[model samples]
Target: MLRRGMILVFSVLLLLSGSMTVFAAGKTGEGATPSGIPLAGLEAFVDNYVKEYIGQKTVGASVVMVKDGQVVLSKGYGFADVEQQIPVSPDTVMEWGSISKLAVWTSVIQLAEQGKLDLNQDIRSYLPPDFLTRLKYSEPVTMLNLMNHNAGFEEYMFDMAYQSPEEVQSLEAGLRLAQPAQIFRPGEVVAYSNYGNSLAAYIVELISGQPYHDYVQEHIFEPLGMQDSIAYSVVEDRPELLEHKAKGYFFEEEGSFTQGSWNYMSMYPNGGNNGTAEDLAKFAMAFMPAAGEQSPLFEKPETLENMLARSYSTAEGMPGIAHGFWEYPGTLRTLGHGGNTIAFATNLQIVPEDRFAVIIMTNQAGESNIVHGLTKEIVGMRELTETVDLPDTSEVQGEFMAARRPGYGFMKLFPYLTLMKLKPQGENQLQVSLAGMTGSYQQVEPYLYQKVGGDSALDVWPMLYAKMGDGKVEAISVYTSDYLPLPAGRTMPVLIINAVLAVLAVAYFIISPFVLLVQAVLKKRRASRHSVSGAGSRRLVTCLSLTGTGIVANNLILALRMLSNNERAYSEVYPQLVINYVLTGLAVLFVAALLISWTSKRSALTVRDKRAAILPIVMIAVLAGLLVFWQFYS
Candidate 1:
């Protein structure tokens, strides 16, 4: 099934790369050639492209493009409420999602500019003593680490977002509740951290003596005259803006969508901004200005320059992250961010070199062709000349996992299951397969590679490949999740065996009840006496079987929780987590019972009886050990 899925995706990628059209631009527009890559007829191209996806993939979307400090295109597609026949207009407001992180970073820079906060200084210096309670390391985490998203925090999921406005807590309260354990030393890994971003906002609040939301409003939003936009989640107080806000939707089927609840987050600084696409365009434009003009957001051009500078990368010489923005490979360098909420998705990209920008927002959740595919087409990829001396690729071929994954809890082992594999396709080419998607990359230089041809905009290439290590490929960095080498025992064979065992273990218990009933009936019919060994082994087998069955049931529930990702899951996780711990205790009892049964019953059991009982016990024991190793209990 997995192989077929990968093959299907790979085939689609080939088809897309071969037939995809270049998104064009209006020739008469001021910024038409801002990228210096002529997009002849972009307006018509965008219209046709977006028209096809409007009702199918997204109920509504707002798209705006700016060039040479002028609005080249500002258009809305589909219905804000499909049932109401209400068209999405320029005034339609939408959730900005993670693109909201930009305002937080901008605030950080403003503080740095005022000398109220230092980027390199330890963040703990700004916080109240004993504020952080989840550190696994004593290393001082700095503001630079927060901006670079390498603060070593795990991906703590629960309580960060809720569907109810009342569930939203204060920024400080949210940070403390969702605070994740640090599993890596500061600066050692580039795990993207939302808590880190919000923590920076808390520091802003602590220094400015204002709530984080107020600080953004007074300093950033008001300055840009984005009165229609609000930094707060839910925007419960802004009735006017709320009324205009496009209803968020989840695609049900073709030409069908269901309205989803608004995404409310207590740590609103990271991803809870709701605003119009025009307002987001203004924010994107601020990051990139006309050559000699300084942005109104900053006191000086140098501050903006420093903020846009590279802070972290998986490999050196690759364009990775620029403060809060992600760098994309193009003829002209591009920096931007993508965002999502419960029912909306957005993209913001800026070609700083050309003072050109594109902002896309959709009412759809999870996936959007315009937000991802059309935007990628707008900010196109370019080939770079490769002539530098670099290391060989043969030694770097292996499995890797995303750095942005849960470092602790029952979810810790999830990343291992979808390990990314890089196989050598040629001396200078490698095929990457991960999470059911495969793409081919051709090495341009010693350590840099570009995606060959991808059907989807979500393909892993045109990446500024950062091979970050002394002489070996330690980790390869992408825009978002950098890939780290898989640890020992997480190879494909081991994972396949583990999956097979999980399935067989579930199967054993599933069929055992009927098998036992049939055996009892047959014995009664024959009036046969139970074997002495079988009777002695029954208790131990029952204990082991109960433990194994309980573990399977617990995992099944957790898997369902993952699939039904909604507001209630946050409250449900703790109860499920406690069950995981109880199952571990039962597993311990199984081991003890097996030890006693094997030693005490050895003399009485016949070879067939011993073989039948012992193998399953041993198999259950191995399965339990594997689960423990994967940290499934916590």
Candidate 2:
């Protein structure tokens, strides 16, 4: 099934890359070329592109462009509420998603400027004692660390948001509910963390003696005169704003739009802003160096500059993120952040050098393609400066796992882990497979690859690899159109061997019992000359049958629950914990049964059978160890 999915995705990528090239060639006349187009010309070009993009992709979108620290255009495309036939306008309220992080960071800068907080001070200082889970590492997480996404907290997945107002908790309560395990040491790697930002916001709340939502509303939104905007700590609490807000939708079966429920984040500081494009433009404009006294942002020019500087990088040569904005490495210095929910996608870009910024918000899922296209048309994307030729392809062929593992605790062992398999295609070329998606990339420079063809063809960003002291590649980073760049760690062969052994052990349990039963019944004797059909054999078979049946039943129940309840299924504690305990008990019994069968003379096994048993025994032991490793059995 996975192989077929990969093939279909790869085919689509080829079609897209081919179509894009053909579409570019089809263009003619003065507007044919996007490059060197003046700002005046860009407005018309963008207007047409956005209209076509909206017709093709979304129910509606709100776009705002700022040039020279002034709003040049703020307009909406398509219908805000399709059922009501209401056309969207610049004033239409839209969910800004993670773009809300901008305001949160701005608040941090404001506090720092006031000398009310120190950027380098331990964040735990601002919170109540034991606010965060303590790890072995003693290095304190600082404001600087959180802003740069190096605070090292694992992604927290549960209780992140609620579907209804009643389910929503206060910021303090929410933080406690979603408290993440700090797995990495401070400043170790730039794992983009939403929890880290929310923690920072909680710190803001602690120091200012103001609720996170209230502080941002009082300082950032109100000061900017964004009358149409409201920052909500809990999205459901704003039932009054529903009349002005666009309904979120997703492309469903047959490319039809399906309305999705609005989810309210308890930590609204991270991604809970609902506002108009014009209002967000005002917020974006505040970051411009040209704003001077006119800027609504309380941070000084020097402070804003500091906010835009590259704060932390996982690798030396890789383009690192700024305090809040992610760095889009190119010939031009572009800092921006893109955001998504189940039913909405949005992007905001700031080219400080050009004194320009663009915010594109859409009421549709997976519609970031529109945001990327329109932004590039307005502000031409420059080529990444190629530095060196590709080295030997053999050096890069291996497996890698995402550095930011899925946050579901023991769920990391799930097959859904986005592992990367890189196979050399030829000189300077490679085939990359991840999460059932396959693509081919050509090395553009020493360690950078341009995704020339694949389902990920839209990922125009060059892939980067960093090497260790041994001259072997340590990790590789890949970026999708809207996702933060993900660095995947290298893995050795031993892990693969263990995984294979575990699968074989499970397979043996599944089929061997039936085979032995048929042999014993037909021959009216033991299956082998040295084997016995006595108490020891019966005990071993019983243990194997129980373990195999339990695993199947647990997974089937989980699959059914997901199919029926969807999001509601995730709201509860992980169901896998119950299964993990059962598996552990069954594994213990299986090992004990094997030991009894081995020692009993009546169940004496042939050398070949004993050798076969060793694999399954080792596999069971490995499973037991993993249960402990992931804290499922403990």
Candidate 3:
């Protein structure tokens, strides 16, 4: 009776709290899997680490660790569906996010092995003529450019994903809709491009005379027996798999969580794999070929070896890309990819030399701890060979902006706002801050810095390659993207100045109406002599004030709408752009009127009469200048 009463009390509290959590039962993968590795402690370690974050940071999570061609650990925790009180099991499928790119890369290699695809030849040779409409340079983009993520395409911000599964478009149509301009020349400026990866997938479709998914189903998934996985936006083709899929969630606080919409992508190859933890373990095991055995994913053992070889590096003795896999900091050479969807997160890492691997998946929106933190602990710290005579990091101390950001339009401001600040932490070390994730790095080589410690974001990006120019750092490369020096207009001081000016302008506009009302009432009460300030001046102030307020209102409305939605297709972005253009035109007209008034010099406007008009004019003009400098109008 006591135990039952206690359980009832716990249930009532759970209802009151709203963030339902159950100590979800777990299940092990069924197989005659062997475990010769000294990784027995890993299962307990993962459980302890995961228990801390299950209710606080993530609703449910699945973890699988493998070593020496055997399953070290595979388990699930917490609730897959909190409202339904359904406990997550080993078979509970979750989105694989960018880890889906592994399949695309694998397919690329399979064709290359077959002598059907050229890694060095121009990708344009394979695509239909004029398929690329936004080239800025005449240089050829090769398959390597896509793999290394230096194809120079700008980050396409919208229509790559939709909220509704019904909105899924064909792969070709999705590519056409979100194709970004070639912002940089080919073979330079490494930026993580989703469009580039999907384009590669499309190339697979064109070359094989089959859809990319079908090709994957035959070449990669079927060989590894990853039957529980689907790489498209929705699993309509596999209803049973979809039924087992865990619903994604967004955690607000301790005991508060909201369901998140599934991210339906037409550019699905970039980040759309959904599967069970056990099945992903099977996929991960493909990379670790046992002695006298060949990887089933590749036709030849040499082909798999070549695919894992270093494909790109920003500096010598630094972690880089092995074909499509980003190198991870580990005791040995660890290579794999991490992924994120709207609400699901996953990571797959393998130490090929050690034949060890780890996979973590969670149904948490923009997850951190499990996918990054737990993985880091699993793939222990790499022993540095350059411990003695470490290089100094003085030249790299400054604010920088990531290269993996929209290089066009108003959305460009986002990269600036999340600027990375690197400052001296101690001798031979520097503290790094970007996007609310902070960490410290010690210079192991002249241009290479390894992450000593940080939050999950830094864990996700553990090593950096800094380029020195003259006396300062030119760029800092981290996995798929690089961080370049912040332009003068994008510096923190300049942004603060812009913000202070905008606040003053909005504050002025907000209060100006009350002032005008008082003046009207007084004028009605008593007809005084002709006012000192000219009607032209009053009209200018009132018009500029109204325009400024309107711009602010429009921005707030758009932001609120976007933030409130679980999915973002950016269908409304075009209309918002039109509104911005109209407001910009009004601003231009105001500038013209003010310029014409000043040039005419028909009246000697003084402080008592003209100062009020000048304040708004100065404020708005400076704000406009800053916006133009930051490419907000583009």
Candidate 4:
């Protein structure tokens, strides 16, 4: 009860602080206008962009643009169902993915307005008493924390969403299974979390005394007149709606397209709405007041105002998270969210000051840049106004790990696994190599850099470096309007050497059995002069062969299982763990045998042979150590 009272006070502080921040950020006139590019010629530019994308064989896409509470453009490009040759249109239904989080967030605001929910109260107050048993931090997880994406839940991977409705579990069941232990104290650093959003929606369900689906239908969709939209918990539950849904596709290696499987959401509110571009644009309109008319969807204008305000941000002013929206921090001051599921990508962006909004939906996954490009064209986002001066970055050269504070035992090896190289370009600029792509950044402040090249709106994109007490660079967090901090790990050198050696060892192991067989055939056919070897050496050779083969086989099985049935494969973690231990034991045995052969008097090996055996022994030992570090044998 005391905790509840404290939270209520905290909630009031957030409101007061939010209003101050908005005032400080200033009103419409204070911010920069849309890029100087004329809005008149933007339609043709977008049409040409979509045509080029279609020429590249993009499966399908729907785009809607609105300005001043009026629909400016609404159209689709390419085939919705390639095999059936169905053309997509503005009304084509597509899974909105994480963009659906907006509905969940808006519903929360509705309840808050009605005094049915408290943003500051402990989430446990709304959940079943025994629902969440693991708590790693002393601080309570509040609704505001969830909204800010600072709830401290570890990244959830297993059984997140499914391909079929039959495979999905109830929301309570999925939460119970996927619920992660708290890693940081609530309201710590930001880490985007789907589980956090789902939990918030579940809280909405409890307070409103209605199922989550029904509540959103009656309150949001119906009120917005979005007849084509449905926030479904299970994908296959609505077959009639499914008929209008655009089939999602993926590009293949042969330059062909393969239809992706349907995604049945387990965490419904995280990314589960399916709708048309026109319908979503309607919902986006409700967020802005039209001609002195307040939103029918929101109870009060103040609530809408607060929802659109900057709720949480880092010190350097990178818009971190705003209520349910992911701020596209730029000169335009846009509020939006990008969503990606199994095969579809969706983006909804709104520039409230201009009363302009856009929703882009695609049948292909990972096309966020396409939507961003469209927005940039429409707004004519400007280039950097002023280039901030920088300090010397001579000492800041090295590899940086994409920092993730793993809360679960299985994720202990996370820090040592991610890698990024910061190569010094000049005195004030550096190039970042991440996942085979290079991004050039110019130092703006003492420790921050803004990415160069691309739309001018992204000039505000910040890459901040945190230093240790002794003044050495400690960790680097890049702001893409979303915070991702990657700290330097000490294991890079060791991991690099180990990775090279392991690759060589696995390659030799795979080819050795076949090579031996071919050699035996050659010896028999050619009538070899020298016999093979002594009994003890031959036995040792056989043992090493079997162990290497087993290692290769185990990896193949796990990979195949993951591709066939991901959820089932996840449940096989214990089995994989057991296999790892068994393999480690086998590695130790092979090493012992090699030692015994090289040292014992009974061994009949030559000096060169003994030295040759050391390579495999070293290889196995390195692998064994890696397994131990990874807790693979635990």
Candidate 5:
């Protein structure tokens, strides 16, 4: 009876605390005619602004405002799925992406605390033997480099070709393929590499003799009581309770949308984890040294300090990166990480000194601006308004001309075709042409333009707003291109190519049976004359055999490319077309080998058959060479 009473009291206290937070948040900006605005008024303004601004963008978002180490305003807005009509709530499980880096980093520090791992020592000491020899650099990379993103490794999963897990040869092989050459030297410049984080996870696995996800779960999640969190790519038996599992979508062709597949199954630690907002709040609470005993993760204050400190700055001239967060230099210090997947974008921030934190998760790609704007407004910073002011046409025109001048303007083709040109469109608008395409821009504000272009008719041409102040305007470039319809004249060539390929395949299939029948008839007639098949039959057999050999060789090459790089390549024309070529080659090779063996003298021609297998032998050698190239060079 006494324990029941205590439980009731505890529940009441929690209820009271939640009510007070809501009340304080609501009353912040109330009843302010003059002098200074009430705190309630400010809070109301922030809430209303987020609803008004972010809501119109069709973004599903959750915001938590904490003050004095207490949640003041925690609310969810919009829908998790617009089509399904599922509303978002605070309990919604959103992908934390790179924010999981913090949890992994914490585990590393814990290992260090236990004297099992050293942050300053060479990481190769902890890694497997095979991985050590595969690295390009002589100097070993350290844990610090991985934590601060100083390890020279390219982002392996950025390409669209590598979006499927099945395309990779194997987890280990994929890691080998993703390894990057040291661009500068270790600790020279901070370059964020998803591949580097993956390697770190591998190292952790090597040291702990456990899977990366399992290690983090045992050390970080379980200790912190983050019950709702799980590593990325994990297939849970019951995923519905996790809630707010927002589906990711990408613009396939400008405005045309397509659902993106779960692309992070091959590597989870880098940017593929999911959790609830409140659970993350609990995770942030672990950073408070005062909550040391209550927190399950870390007991030392130095761990928090080390993780929050600005470890390095990005080489691309961005703000400094902390252990797993970005540091903003100011009196009001902030540390956090921003995550972006196909459909969702999230930001987790903590201002430990102020005992405040913010978690903003959205289901839209461009909702980051809204999240940033709302965060500043809630924190009583300057309001971001849509200001309209025309720039001096002469200045705008001059800047445009400078961008178009020789040595200043350039074009490149490899990944895609791109070209840039600058010319005047109207009195106040300047036109920039790219890839034989044109876009008209009207100056709405200084360094801001409302751009419209000819390409996809349904494409969204939102206003391009530059952050440059009074200095020269930075050149505006679109990250995604608008899809274009080919000219009427170009359709015939495509159709002709398809027709030719189809006819050839049909003819080959149709002629093969006839050839076999003719050979059978001739062989039966010549059975008494010779023990071996007729010359015509042998010629048909050889043709089929050679064709089959060519097909298999081509297919093996294609499959390897797809597995190693998540892409198909046939020379350089269409890298993805080799998948089909490979399939055709394999089919032809099997049939040819069968036909040739059937026609040859089974017992007497073993040596001759061995010699005939030279083509396949060479093909295997080439395949082996390609595999080696993919592992080490590609």
Candidate 6:
């Protein structure tokens, strides 16, 4: 059945791609091609492209461009729900993936500015003993290391922990696993570490003695008047507050929309947060303080300057890390982070020096790259003093449904499968009662779904459904959950295997150094037995050298894997998926390197040569087994 579904998904993808090509070809002549473009021409070009090209595309998106502290253009494009023909709006709330990192960083910096926290202080000083146990080095890891990504922690560890319950027994359990060896000394070169950010959040929570979400809301969000924004998992049960929440979509294939899961996890500070594009604009504006008064949230010039300063370089040879944001080198000096989950992708770029910024939120996955391109284009065009009218969406009509069924066949099964009871209360209004929860939804026209109930069980009820014809309705989409914790009663074998692998990895790191030292001593003793120029002695030396190099390489790889795995354990608490992929890729690379070294030693060799080869080979095999176990059977 899964295979059939896979085939069906692939077929739909091909159709969508083919259709997009045809559509793009048909609209090729809708705008003028300007040669030797001026700012006016650029503005005209961008407006036409967004409205005629991107706006007509299937997915929903919001774009806001600011220049010199003023909003030059802010518009919504496409349908929040295509089946209901709902047009996107600037007020639509979106799950802005990793962009949430900036929010976390902002809150932390606020504490630092208040002299309540210190960037140079060791994180272990703030965290509990259990959390401290997971760290690798004897020396302290400072807040600066965490912010600059110089802590040498694995990016995948945090992601995995956020997604898999068994991988991370608790927040404390995940932290305990972080105590591996450091990849590099603190304040060396920068490496992107989601785990580092997550740990930073944990440190903030420890120091403030507040829940991570509460600290950010009280200090940063509320002060900025970003009332619409909330930590992602906190608002799940309150559909009313989420009435304007935009539906998130994932591509069955490239450029095709399909329902995707909502990411609900406890790691809200790291990357699990949601807000409206308008609110995001306000947040960006705060970065550019007005002439007379200071920002209510951050009143100091030095505070703002420190936040925007480039702290580290990224692998791309660009200025990578700022205090709580990313910096790109150029006259513009943009700072931002792009976020993605299964369903949504978002970006918030700020040019503090020019007092310009762009906030882009898209319901569609895989659309962030395109949105970033469009944002850059719009920013360049803002120099022009031209107006571009938004497209109208008054003609779209109909009820939004959740699914399509084969006529009577679905009605027969509906009673058995339907988890929520829904009834139509008035024109374009629905009263939904589910799991002892009741809420109302009113169709606001052109595909927007709004909750209008005066009294409801949910604090925020943002349910939008699209009628898919033939008596089936699809629920409106929202944020995707990172990894739903398994039911308490269910046993997770995969977690057990991961724990075992983690133990073995620890054992290898602990024992490999001692083994290498003993081998070195033995080699010195053997050197005295024969002339160093003999062919036999030369072969022995060659074998020993290769073996030593392989061992060192294997141990280095294991150490990295261990640290990354620890990060994955915590990442299960967040909603980012990129970290998981990175972790998997690194695990594969580690194993491959070990295998290559092992294969190179299979030829005829002396006892000393074999011993050198055997240790690394054994370590590699154990690590491979562990990874396989964790990936599949675990």
Which candidate has the highest TM-score of all?
A: 3
Of the pair 3 and 5, which is ahead by lDDT? 3
lDDT of 4 by residue, 32-108 (tens): 22554344544555666766456254667787767666676676776677777666766678998888888889999
lDDT of 6: 0.53
Task: Give residue 554's lDDT in candidate 4 (0 to 100).
Answer: 71
Which lDDT tens digits does candidate 5 get at residues 1-634? 9999997675433322211224333434443311133445544554566554333443467666554444555666655655564556667677776677777777787788778888889987886676745455677689888887766553333221235445534335556654554543676534466666777777777788887888987887888687877865442423664444765544344223444544344556766677777677767767753544433565666766776777764222223567656653222566666666546677676766666666777666535444554544333221123555566544533211111111110010111123344456776676756556566766655555555444321122223333332664333322111111222432446435544543454344345556657756876876544335334334434555445444444444644654444422122324334443453455456546545655666434344444544543344344333323223112
lDDT of 3 by residue, 166-284 (tens): 99999999998777989888887899999999999999999999999889888878888888888777876689898888888987998678998887889999998788877888888
Worst 10 residues of 2 by lDDT: 17-26
Root-mean-square deviation of Cα positions for candidate 4 versus the true structure, in angstroms? 11.8
Candidate 6: residue 562 Cα off by (Å): 19
Candidate rank order under TM-score: 3, 1, 4, 2, 5, 6
- Compared with the true structure, model 1 gives a TM-score of 0.86
lDDT of each residue in 415-507, candidate 2, tens digit only: 234567777887788888876777777766676665656753244344555344476765666542112222333144545665675566556
- Candidate 5's displacement at residue 391, Å, is 24
* Number of the top-ranking candidate, with lDDT as the measure: 3
* TM-score of candidate 4 on Cα atoms, chains taken together: 0.82
Count clashing pairs, candidate 5: 15
The lDDT of model 2 is 0.65
For residues 165-269, what per-residue lDDT tens digits would candidate 1 score against the true structure? 888889998887777888788988888888899999999999999998899999999888788899999787799998988888888998778988888999989
lDDT of 4 at 331: 54
Superposed by TM-score, candidate 1 places the C-alpha of residue 445 at a distance from the truth, in angstroms, of: 2.3
Give TM per candidate.
Answer: 0.86, 0.77, 0.89, 0.82, 0.56, 0.53
- Flag regions of model 1 displaced more than 4 Å: 1-29, 33-40, 250-260, 290-292, 314-317, 386-395, 455-461, 464-471, 489-497, 520-526, 531-544, 566-571, 583-612
